[model samples]
Target chain A: MAVSVLTQKKNMPAGNPVERLLAATADDMARVNSLILSRAESHVDMVPELARYLIDSGGKRLRPMLTVAAAQLFGGGAGNAVNFAAAVEFMHNATLLHDDVVDESDMRRGKPAARMVWGNKASILVGDFLLGQAFMMMVETGDIGSLGVLSAASAVMAEGEVFQLAKTGDLATTEADYAEVIRAKTAVLFEAACEVGAMSGGADAAGRAALARYGLELGNAFQLVDDALDYGGQSGALGKNVGDDLREGKMTLPVILALAAGNEAEKAIIASALGKADASDLEVSQVVAIFNRHDTLNRTLEKADAHARTAVEALGILPESEMKTILADVVMHSVRRAS
Target chain B: MAVSVLTQKKNMPAGNPVERLLAATADDMARVNSLILSRAESHVDMVPELARYLIDSGGKRLRPMLTVAAAQLFGGGAGNAVNFAAAVEFMHNATLLHDDVVDESDMRRGKPAARMVWGNKASILVGDFLLGQAFMMMVETGDIGSLGVLSAASAVMAEGEVFQLAKTGDLATTEADYAEVIRAKTAVLFEAACEVGAMSGGADAAGRAALARYGLELGNAFQLVDDALDYGGQSGALGKNVGDDLREGKMTLPVILALAAGNEAEKAIIASALGKADASDLEVSQVVAIFNRHDTLNRTLEKADAHARTAVEALGILPESEMKTILADVVMHSVRRAS
Candidate 1:
């Protein structure tokens, strides 16, 4: 425990996240972090280099936040969400690191990916290390329903990834198919995000289901918006390259919706553009224009609005608090972000 | 249960593997084709297409055999080794799948690597799937020591991979460093093989430790032999090209020992062969001749012999039995083959 002082902040930040959250969720966050480090400590000495590299990478801690918050929302226990949060975060990062290794993508946010910095092998093995660690965390939670949800969700996520890989670069994907893929790929995290919250918060069956539904809908909208931005936005605003998704041959919602609304000539043109390694800048511009014409951007925004409304509705069972407002804001950010 | 009659083997082989391992691990080579289809059945719909495709593609299954035989040697328990066997097998395959993806390796055991066959993303995620499944299985063993050995070994194996990647083509690898890598990379599984067995079979502390030492030494020799053969054996016999490890810039035992023994001229030859993508046959031949003259092959074999002997020595704690003989023969075969 002497080592804990080294990591503890001498001057803690001003914002009180747990105080803002329902049922002392900020305290829950502190508790979760402690458990995560403790659980990870078993693996720490053995992989001195990788364990240090990955944990110190400073992830945003969004997934774990959702876990604890959901638990608080329903006015139940704090400990369950802490474990769920740690476990879910572990699973999330594991996939991200592995995704980088497979895509050979060089960057994560603004920094180099774990694979780029630590090499692909550590990126992968540490990813695995986290995955196993996640299960241990889940088991510690001792909630069978919670376990069932997380396990089933994780399996589906893997399948979704496989489906995405199979369809990548192919122009045959429809808006519906793209929606399904993104739902599996990204929204499940959102779903887990909300469901784990309520489950840990000790919401009754109907209440917990409501939060899960909210999370599922919100997650779907969030990913659709992300796909749209990855295709349509500029790097200056997005902090990443536009059309990076297209370059990888990923047929996102904008592309799929645009094609469905376009004439045959336009469809064929878009298909040809996707096939080219160097589809002209002019052609890419034309596709973007077609998306605008089809009102795909507006439609995506409308869906996001629906998810945000649903996200708030899911928490209706909870007594209103400042933390509740933040959850609503997070949902807004998920679906409504422009860049 | 109905599926067995549905998916029944067309021609099941006679004789349990316990009876055949004494003939040499090589001669008994074939799929046990059990536990996998049943245990992974929850993901069964995808099994034929996704899970089974790469698994049945022909792997050594050495880890599982080590697990099963180790348990049997100590005295059987009620289906305990079955879980241990499944756990080790899953861990081994998980490593291979991730390894193939990271290494960009196209072939494994003379067949297409999982990444090459199913695409890298599937290989990566399925590897995650199996890993999650492995932890789930190991937990059912109801022994914390079983969980401890398997999880710790998983961490070590992963770290070994990271170390190997970091040290690639670095001429500084000594025998001790190589030994550490091999212990982590290979010996940990061997140790798990024996530890899991002893625990499941109700062996006492002394028996368990002795068997664990046997597996650890056995794995070390097994890896040493594999490394030596990568440089010296026929491509046809090994089912991979000679010096494939060198081609990939992997610093194995022979290469490290050879480099340590070589003069400036010999070192120059090895560097030229390894660093170039378009490495010429003439350059490779020159390095091979230098290795031949340095007696690297003989020295490597001697080391393998010493490890194999140590493995057998560890088994001295066990009472004389048919199981012990089979395990002893396995240690002999580990280093006896030229390839």
Candidate 2:
């Protein structure tokens, strides 16, 4: 299995390599955190209440950390990186809030989703508020190139979500469709975050392009690992309800692979469980058993490893530095989460 | 009633003044229309489907027209005004989609609300897509000042909606509180629309300030009339289900005024209907009876008249032209909708 292979090859600190990247960007990240908190404020009570509920909730701030780390890699100081990072975080949280409403998800980051506490209407409006604040932060930077990148990402992410919604419950969904879904919904933002960070860091055309490729490949690997984790990882480690993707009928890579490889009887088992909110634990285990028989989860992990390798390769254009090493490790750590 | 006063004064052509404003800015507005439709395109089927449902609906493009007209006022040629106008329209429609979800509205522009057709999830996501596109359009203009104005308006609009939600069914809501709600929820966007249009048109500091004031006052007047109409005007004319505000328990000015002046017996009747989804026509008429007895609807029109006059006065700084005169007429037309 790819997980066993991944585990045997890795020898690093117990903590996530992502954590190391965070430490390298700690000071800039602190400023980003402060700006995030301060900008969430509003005279209208619910704006801050709902915003803080999501922002202060324990997200690793990985996307924004990537933003800051990417900037630092190019020797960018605490210039527009702080604002861009904060804006990226806001965009991520905003999507989370809306996605919860769309998915009817009750749990997020091991806590009740904002929609659960505040109602769908509040969640939706506050999400809009966060996005507005995000754009406001970008505008204040007067960096038109960064603004375009982020805004385009925002549009693509929405399209990705809609496409996923359309494909839900469809067993015939192709890997190409799955790839497009992840690319638009997940990888595009990562690409934009790193690209904008590069732009703010005074990256030339080549450096900026390299960072964008790095972010996209890393994002693809991260999503693949996450999809596999939904089937195999601990719920506590994942910080979400187990079998959520299966329950929601998401056409992730592992499920698609399993479906493609399975016999008729095995397909029937997954069909019954897919999109069933009340699908029993026994049903999920049944599906997992089938996945194991086909080695689909490992195959998914193998694909993730391929993307992660490409992500590391993307960093070759940049001069070697401690930050670059950490970034590369972060890519590996994302895929290793399933290990 | 203020309607009588408005109709008697200096009658312009029988044509709708909004149509006149449209004619004055036809070229730029046509461009804005094309940009709006083009930007709504996405590979995701639902994105364009829901977006077109709202954008192609029969509602007059008043906000974007204000943007184009403001540009024309400064003799602006083909410039960023087209992009800003399209951006303003997208922002307006984005709010409409979300508002339908928040208000549980089934009707908009004399048709089923997008939420009703595509479900609330699609509506929310597509609304988000539009806002993203709006920001992209603004970024493409490379006008950071205009971008800041539009984004700030977006934040205020969300805050306003939340404020209104909090005040829903609040019996003791004050006139000032009601004013604040509309100012944030409605007027700020109008102000931003004209302000950005003026900025794109290369208006001087005084000219920009004047357009901002004009837009703010016009928006205030327009909303006041609309709120009053919720109690008195035809649903067909409004392109909304009559009594929608009452059904949603929106703390509109007429309702607030009636509540303040209402005796306990009348207050009881209003409360019974406020926020009641099943509130019958009989109950609505009962609330209308209370409003008419207090002259509250007339009082709302009078307030609107005051704002409309200020709107015209705000335009006094501009050199008189056919466009300027038509713009002033448009202000009057908005208030006189009740007549």
Candidate 3:
């Protein structure tokens, strides 16, 4: 089962760490996909219609892949990882459906948001439906321990959201606040996914803690890159327009950093554009110019690189397997996107 | 424990079964209430704000009370009925939050709906938060069987809402369809409440089955009476405006029965008013007149009476106790409200 370090290095490509993870876990991924589709089915047509719309939408399903991959690495009979993987995917999608409604977002993943087609009410109810299905999947595994982990993550995620909503446009929102927000809203789920994956895979306490830390740091790196991309990356790459975070008054790291460092006039331009919802592209460019002058976007990416390094470091405690190597590479690739 | 039938009858008052049941489970109900309020707390202020708004809005807490009463009826140890009871209340309040948003309701329990005060987005997110908290409470109980039952009920309830939405204005919605809707939307939760209560109370299989049947039939009767009251009883007694269901285009049994028996003109009146969201009082009375012509209100009450009788019959298997008598009387009172 041991591969030479040279072979491992050659097999790890700079591009498509996510794709590599998915391929490594492809067999389990197929089972997870089938479980997801079957559970999304309901006697109510709209339940399936709206659910399938979001589930079938083209996305990497990176979260579930992480789950399956983490389980594969530990190799503990793959006990209910399929169910847990599907549960993780549903949880992630449920948040997306709710997020679009909360942000009044019109587009997701190069397609119209589920809220846009079915309206907000349906989106909300269907999001609840998906969440219910997620719990059902967790229960079916009969792993009460994993159920506790996932359920706690769900609450933390909601609190993170409400916290973000409260701080949406606050100019004085600090870096520490941003860290708390991302930790709860994004990284906690990732940590739970990996931790539960390890639990089902028969990992010892140290192995579980290592994966948890890996997922958390990787999630932080992922979101930081996403925030920087909102200001500097292509809309095609982002799956939305550039500067959406600014338009929505999201106090992302780049904005928080730029605001803290900007002169009086630069601060004025950002304050005017942020949270406007209809802030023109010209206004976005002005904000971007300010971000450039302050070097906040690159600084945000720099922070992402630091976290990605920590994420890779987290994986060092685990035994060297191809899955572990791919997972570490995936963390690096996420931050490399911004670079 | 072996009280005579006559003694049971003498102790049970026909006038206030729900109140009697509440009194019977007062201590457990108090713990459930405290747990509910404590669990509703969050670092995110909006969550507690919106959650408390709905949780404290004068709900009867009948579902949670049933959980407590069912648990207390058996002399089994009260393992975690407090947690299950609070979980049931949270689940009920969660539905109310989402229901207000879906129904576009401006008022609930004689006050402005949460959505009306805080907007639909907050209502939806807070509802999700409460559901998360509900599952967390369930996991704390460490009862996987009961968790499966409640989680299945959650999914079925969401399906019920979506099913009800699908049939909102469809004239072809049959009596069978109406039964399915109510069973999923309302009765399933009741069944789960009693079943889990029995589980927590350390009931044997037969005892659990009996309570489950009791709750299902009582919930059916409760919903049927509420439907009849929408057309025939006082709006003050019902909490919302009379004919609110008709305005929302809910195809309750009374409306379905009237439509089945009425003339084409009557059919037209019912159809036009079904989903208008602003159907006038005169139009409501006209529909009521059609219902009277067919004696549909009386017929709906008859259906409720039949369900209530079944609910009482379900309790016959249990040992004669004050709690059992009060539970039976509560079912009778629910139907008596329509009478």
Indicate which candidate wins on DockQ.
2
**TM-score winner among the candidates?**
2
Q: Is 1 or 2 the stronger prediction by DockQ?
A: 2
Best by lDDT: 2
lDDT of 1 at B293: 75
Which regions of candidate 3 deviate over 4 angstroms? A1-15, A234-240, B1-11, B234-240
Ranking by lDDT: 2, 3, 1
DockQ of each: 0.21, 0.81, 0.67
- Taking the tens digit of each residue's C-alpha lDDT, what string does model 3 give over A13-54? 555877778778888888888899999998788998999998
**Estimated TM-score for each candidate:** 0.80, 0.96, 0.94
List per-prediction Cα lDDT, in the order shown. Answer: 0.69, 0.87, 0.85
1 against 3, candidate with superior lDDT: 3
Error of 3 at A51 (Å): 1.4
Candidate 3 lDDT score at position B286? 83
Better of 1 and 3 by DockQ: 3
Q: How good is the docking of model 2, by CAPRI class? A: high
